[model samples]
Target: MSTGKVVLGTVAGLAVGGILGILFAPEKGSVTRQQILDKGNDYADDLKSKYNGIAETLKEKFQAVKNDAENIAQSGKAKFDEVKNEINRPAANY
Candidate 1:
Protein backbone atom coordinates (compact mmCIF):
# COMPACT_ATOMS: atom_id res chain seq x y z
CA MET A 1 0.00 0.00 0.00
CA SER A 2 0.93 3.65 -0.25
CA THR A 3 2.96 5.38 2.45
CA GLY A 4 0.09 7.67 3.31
CA LYS A 5 -2.26 4.77 3.94
CA VAL A 6 0.31 2.98 6.06
CA VAL A 7 0.96 6.04 8.15
CA LEU A 8 -2.73 6.65 8.62
CA GLY A 9 -3.34 3.04 9.65
CA THR A 10 -0.48 3.08 12.15
CA VAL A 11 -1.64 6.31 13.70
CA ALA A 12 -5.20 5.04 13.96
CA GLY A 13 -4.05 1.84 15.61
CA LEU A 14 -1.98 3.79 18.12
CA ALA A 15 -4.89 6.06 18.96
CA VAL A 16 -7.24 3.12 19.52
CA GLY A 17 -4.72 1.25 21.66
CA GLY A 18 -4.00 4.32 23.77
CA ILE A 19 -7.67 5.00 24.45
CA LEU A 20 -8.31 1.35 25.32
CA GLY A 21 -5.35 1.22 27.65
CA ILE A 22 -6.41 4.37 29.39
CA LEU A 23 -9.91 3.04 29.85
CA PHE A 24 -8.54 -0.02 31.62
CA ALA A 25 -6.18 1.93 33.84
CA PRO A 26 -6.88 2.45 37.58
CA GLU A 27 -6.97 6.21 37.25
CA LYS A 28 -10.03 8.25 38.23
CA GLY A 29 -12.61 9.11 35.59
CA SER A 30 -11.55 12.76 35.36
CA VAL A 31 -7.90 11.82 34.89
CA THR A 32 -8.76 9.18 32.31
CA ARG A 33 -10.77 11.70 30.31
CA GLN A 34 -7.91 14.17 30.42
CA GLN A 35 -5.45 11.57 29.24
CA ILE A 36 -7.69 10.64 26.33
CA LEU A 37 -8.02 14.29 25.34
CA ASP A 38 -4.27 14.75 25.43
CA LYS A 39 -3.66 11.61 23.45
CA GLY A 40 -6.19 12.64 20.85
CA ASN A 41 -4.51 15.99 20.37
CA ASP A 42 -1.12 14.35 20.09
CA TYR A 43 -2.38 11.88 17.49
CA ALA A 44 -4.03 14.71 15.55
CA ASP A 45 -0.79 16.65 15.47
CA ASP A 46 1.16 13.60 14.32
CA LEU A 47 -1.33 12.93 11.53
CA LYS A 48 -1.12 16.54 10.39
CA SER A 49 2.66 16.38 10.33
CA LYS A 50 2.64 13.19 8.28
CA TYR A 51 0.10 14.68 5.86
CA ASN A 52 2.18 17.80 5.37
CA GLY A 53 5.29 15.77 4.69
CA ILE A 54 3.47 13.70 2.08
CA ALA A 55 2.02 16.82 0.48
CA GLU A 56 5.43 18.44 0.26
CA THR A 57 6.94 15.34 -1.31
CA LEU A 58 4.17 15.20 -3.89
CA LYS A 59 4.62 18.87 -4.72
CA GLU A 60 8.34 18.43 -5.21
CA LYS A 61 7.85 15.42 -7.47
CA PHE A 62 5.27 17.28 -9.55
CA GLN A 63 7.61 20.23 -9.96
CA ALA A 64 10.42 17.96 -11.13
CA VAL A 65 8.14 16.34 -13.71
CA LYS A 66 6.94 19.73 -14.92
CA ASN A 67 10.50 20.93 -15.36
CA ASP A 68 11.40 17.82 -17.33
CA ALA A 69 8.37 18.28 -19.59
CA GLU A 70 9.24 21.91 -20.26
CA ASN A 71 12.84 21.01 -21.09
CA ILE A 72 11.72 18.29 -23.47
CA ALA A 73 9.30 20.67 -25.19
CA GLN A 74 12.02 23.29 -25.62
CA SER A 75 14.41 20.74 -27.06
CA GLY A 76 11.77 19.56 -29.51
CA LYS A 77 11.07 23.11 -30.57
CA ALA A 78 14.75 23.81 -31.09
CA LYS A 79 15.12 20.69 -33.25
CA PHE A 80 12.10 21.69 -35.33
CA ASP A 81 13.54 25.16 -35.87
CA GLU A 82 16.89 23.73 -36.93
CA VAL A 83 15.22 21.44 -39.48
CA LYS A 84 13.08 24.31 -40.79
CA ASN A 85 16.13 26.55 -41.23
CA GLU A 86 17.98 23.80 -43.13
CA ILE A 87 15.00 23.28 -45.47
CA ASN A 88 14.71 27.02 -46.21
CA ARG A 89 18.46 27.48 -46.92
CA PRO A 90 19.64 27.62 -50.57
CA ALA A 91 21.22 24.44 -51.98
CA ALA A 92 25.01 24.60 -52.06
CA ASN A 93 26.59 24.74 -55.56
CA TYR A 94 28.02 21.35 -56.50
Candidate 2:
Protein backbone atom coordinates (compact mmCIF):
# COMPACT_ATOMS: atom_id res chain seq x y z
CA MET A 1 0.00 0.00 0.00
CA SER A 2 1.02 3.65 -0.42
CA THR A 3 2.61 5.63 2.36
CA GLY A 4 -0.54 7.62 3.03
CA LYS A 5 -2.65 4.49 3.39
CA VAL A 6 -0.09 2.91 5.68
CA VAL A 7 0.07 6.04 7.84
CA LEU A 8 -3.70 6.26 8.03
CA GLY A 9 -3.98 2.65 9.08
CA THR A 10 -1.31 3.11 11.73
CA VAL A 11 -3.05 6.16 13.17
CA ALA A 12 -6.43 4.45 13.14
CA GLY A 13 -5.09 1.38 14.91
CA LEU A 14 -3.34 3.50 17.54
CA ALA A 15 -6.49 5.51 18.20
CA VAL A 16 -8.61 2.41 18.61
CA GLY A 17 -6.11 0.76 20.94
CA GLY A 18 -5.76 3.89 23.05
CA ILE A 19 -9.53 4.17 23.44
CA LEU A 20 -9.79 0.54 24.47
CA GLY A 21 -7.00 0.87 26.99
CA ILE A 22 -8.51 3.98 28.58
CA LEU A 23 -11.93 2.34 28.83
CA PHE A 24 -10.61 -0.80 30.51
CA ALA A 25 -7.77 0.61 32.63
CA PRO A 26 -7.93 1.73 36.26
CA GLU A 27 -5.18 4.33 35.68
CA LYS A 28 -5.72 8.08 35.85
CA GLY A 29 -6.76 9.92 32.68
CA SER A 30 -3.57 11.98 32.61
CA VAL A 31 -1.33 8.89 32.67
CA THR A 32 -3.14 7.21 29.82
CA ARG A 33 -3.08 10.39 27.78
CA GLN A 34 0.68 10.73 28.26
CA GLN A 35 1.24 7.13 27.19
CA ILE A 36 -0.79 7.60 24.03
CA LEU A 37 1.10 10.77 23.15
CA ASP A 38 4.47 9.08 23.62
CA LYS A 39 3.48 6.11 21.49
CA GLY A 40 2.16 8.36 18.71
CA ASN A 41 5.40 10.36 18.67
CA ASP A 42 7.44 7.21 18.27
CA TYR A 43 5.27 6.00 15.43
CA ALA A 44 5.57 9.38 13.66
CA ASP A 45 9.35 9.29 13.94
CA ASP A 46 9.52 5.83 12.43
CA LEU A 47 7.40 6.87 9.47
CA LYS A 48 9.51 9.97 8.89
CA SER A 49 12.69 7.94 8.73
CA LYS A 50 11.16 5.54 6.23
CA TYR A 51 9.96 8.41 4.03
CA ASN A 52 13.39 10.03 3.94
CA GLY A 53 15.03 6.79 2.87
CA ILE A 54 12.53 6.31 0.07
CA ALA A 55 13.03 9.91 -1.12
CA GLU A 56 16.80 9.47 -1.31
CA THR A 57 16.49 6.27 -3.32
CA LEU A 58 14.12 7.91 -5.78
CA LYS A 59 16.47 10.87 -6.26
CA GLU A 60 19.39 8.61 -7.09
CA LYS A 61 17.35 6.70 -9.65
CA PHE A 62 16.20 9.94 -11.28
CA GLN A 63 19.77 11.21 -11.61
CA ALA A 64 20.94 8.00 -13.19
CA VAL A 65 18.18 8.04 -15.78
CA LYS A 66 18.92 11.69 -16.61
CA ASN A 67 22.62 10.97 -17.10
CA ASP A 68 21.87 8.04 -19.42
CA ALA A 69 19.61 10.20 -21.58
CA GLU A 70 22.26 12.91 -21.86
CA ASN A 71 24.90 10.42 -22.90
CA ILE A 72 22.65 8.96 -25.58
CA ALA A 73 21.92 12.46 -26.97
CA GLN A 74 25.62 13.29 -27.16
CA SER A 75 26.37 10.02 -28.98
CA GLY A 76 23.63 10.71 -31.52
CA LYS A 77 24.95 14.20 -32.20
CA ALA A 78 28.48 12.94 -32.71
CA LYS A 79 27.33 10.32 -35.21
CA PHE A 80 25.26 12.88 -37.12
CA ASP A 81 28.23 15.25 -37.39
CA GLU A 82 30.49 12.47 -38.66
CA VAL A 83 27.98 11.52 -41.38
CA LYS A 84 27.53 15.17 -42.42
CA ASN A 85 31.27 15.68 -42.73
CA GLU A 86 31.61 12.58 -44.89
CA ILE A 87 28.85 13.78 -47.24
CA ASN A 88 30.37 17.28 -47.62
CA ARG A 89 33.83 16.01 -48.60
CA PRO A 90 34.94 16.74 -52.18
CA ALA A 91 34.15 14.03 -54.77
CA ALA A 92 37.06 12.43 -56.68
CA ASN A 93 37.49 13.48 -60.34
CA TYR A 94 37.27 10.80 -63.06
Candidate 3:
Protein backbone atom coordinates (compact mmCIF):
# COMPACT_ATOMS: atom_id res chain seq x y z
CA MET A 1 0.00 0.00 0.00
CA SER A 2 1.02 3.60 -0.49
CA THR A 3 2.63 5.43 2.41
CA GLY A 4 -0.18 7.95 2.65
CA LYS A 5 -2.87 5.29 2.95
CA VAL A 6 -0.81 3.42 5.52
CA VAL A 7 -0.36 6.50 7.64
CA LEU A 8 -4.06 7.31 7.43
CA GLY A 9 -5.04 3.80 8.41
CA THR A 10 -2.65 3.77 11.33
CA VAL A 11 -4.00 7.04 12.66
CA ALA A 12 -7.59 5.84 12.34
CA GLY A 13 -6.80 2.58 14.11
CA LEU A 14 -5.13 4.38 16.98
CA ALA A 15 -8.12 6.67 17.43
CA VAL A 16 -10.56 3.77 17.48
CA GLY A 17 -8.43 1.77 19.89
CA GLY A 18 -8.17 4.74 22.25
CA ILE A 19 -11.93 5.24 22.28
CA LEU A 20 -12.60 1.57 22.92
CA GLY A 21 -10.04 1.44 25.69
CA ILE A 22 -11.61 4.39 27.43
CA LEU A 23 -15.04 2.89 27.11
CA PHE A 24 -14.01 -0.42 28.66
CA ALA A 25 -11.96 1.01 31.49
CA PRO A 26 -13.03 0.36 35.08
CA GLU A 27 -13.47 4.06 35.80
CA LYS A 28 -16.83 5.67 36.53
CA GLY A 29 -19.08 6.47 33.57
CA SER A 30 -18.56 10.22 33.82
CA VAL A 31 -14.79 9.93 34.13
CA THR A 32 -14.55 7.51 31.24
CA ARG A 33 -16.60 9.80 29.04
CA GLN A 34 -14.44 12.77 29.96
CA GLN A 35 -11.28 10.84 29.19
CA ILE A 36 -12.63 9.79 25.82
CA LEU A 37 -13.52 13.39 25.00
CA ASP A 38 -10.08 14.64 25.94
CA LYS A 39 -8.30 11.93 23.99
CA GLY A 40 -10.48 12.53 20.97
CA ASN A 41 -9.66 16.22 21.02
CA ASP A 42 -5.95 15.47 21.26
CA TYR A 43 -6.06 13.02 18.36
CA ALA A 44 -8.04 15.47 16.24
CA ASP A 45 -5.50 18.23 16.84
CA ASP A 46 -2.61 15.94 15.98
CA LEU A 47 -4.25 14.84 12.73
CA LYS A 48 -5.05 18.42 11.82
CA SER A 49 -1.47 19.50 12.31
CA LYS A 50 -0.18 16.62 10.18
CA TYR A 51 -2.73 17.33 7.46
CA ASN A 52 -1.88 21.03 7.35
CA GLY A 53 1.80 20.32 7.07
CA ILE A 54 1.25 17.87 4.24
CA ALA A 55 -1.04 20.35 2.45
CA GLU A 56 1.48 23.17 2.69
CA THR A 57 4.25 20.95 1.38
CA LEU A 58 2.15 19.85 -1.57
CA LYS A 59 1.19 23.44 -2.34
CA GLU A 60 4.77 24.55 -2.42
CA LYS A 61 5.79 21.64 -4.63
CA PHE A 62 2.94 22.37 -7.03
CA GLN A 63 4.00 25.98 -7.37
CA ALA A 64 7.55 24.94 -8.07
CA VAL A 65 6.47 22.46 -10.72
CA LYS A 66 4.22 25.06 -12.38
CA ASN A 67 7.02 27.61 -12.51
CA ASP A 68 9.41 25.09 -14.02
CA ALA A 69 6.88 24.15 -16.69
CA GLU A 70 6.29 27.81 -17.55
CA ASN A 71 10.01 28.44 -17.90
CA ILE A 72 10.42 25.41 -20.17
CA ALA A 73 7.53 26.50 -22.37
CA GLN A 74 8.89 30.00 -22.68
CA SER A 75 12.32 28.65 -23.56
CA GLY A 76 10.87 26.41 -26.27
CA LYS A 77 8.89 29.29 -27.77
CA ALA A 78 11.93 31.51 -27.91
CA LYS A 79 13.95 28.81 -29.66
CA PHE A 80 11.14 28.21 -32.14
CA ASP A 81 10.93 31.92 -32.94
CA GLU A 82 14.69 32.07 -33.49
CA VAL A 83 14.57 29.14 -35.96
CA LYS A 84 11.63 30.66 -37.84
CA ASN A 85 13.46 33.97 -38.16
CA GLU A 86 16.53 32.20 -39.55
CA ILE A 87 14.40 30.30 -42.07
CA ASN A 88 12.70 33.53 -43.26
CA ARG A 89 15.97 35.48 -43.72
CA PRO A 90 16.61 36.58 -47.36
CA ALA A 91 19.63 34.83 -48.95
CA ALA A 92 21.80 36.48 -51.66
CA ASN A 93 22.07 34.60 -54.99
CA TYR A 94 25.54 33.40 -56.07
**Best candidate according to lDDT:** 3
TM-score of each: 0.89, 0.71, 0.85
Compose the digit string of candidate 2's lDDT tens values, residues 1-94. 8977987788778767876876678878898787778777877787789789889999999999999999999999999999887777644321
- Tell me the number of clashing residue pairs for each predicted model: 0, 0, 0
- Write model 3 residue lDDT over 1-94, tens digit each, in one string: 9989998999999999999988888999999989999998999999999999999999999999999999999999999999887777744322
Q: What's the candidate order when arranged by decreasing lDDT?
A: 3, 1, 2
Question: Against the correct fold, how does model 2 do in TM-score?
Answer: 0.71
Q: Candidate 1, residues 4-76: lDDT per residue as tens digits?
A: 6887788889999999999999999999999999999999898788778889999999999999999999999
Runs in model 3 lying further than 4 Å from the true structure? 91-94
The 0-to-1 C-alpha lDDT of every candidate, in the order given, reads 0.91, 0.82, 0.92
List the pairs of residues colliding in candidate 2: none
User: What is the model-wide C-alpha lDDT for candidate 2?
Assistant: 0.82
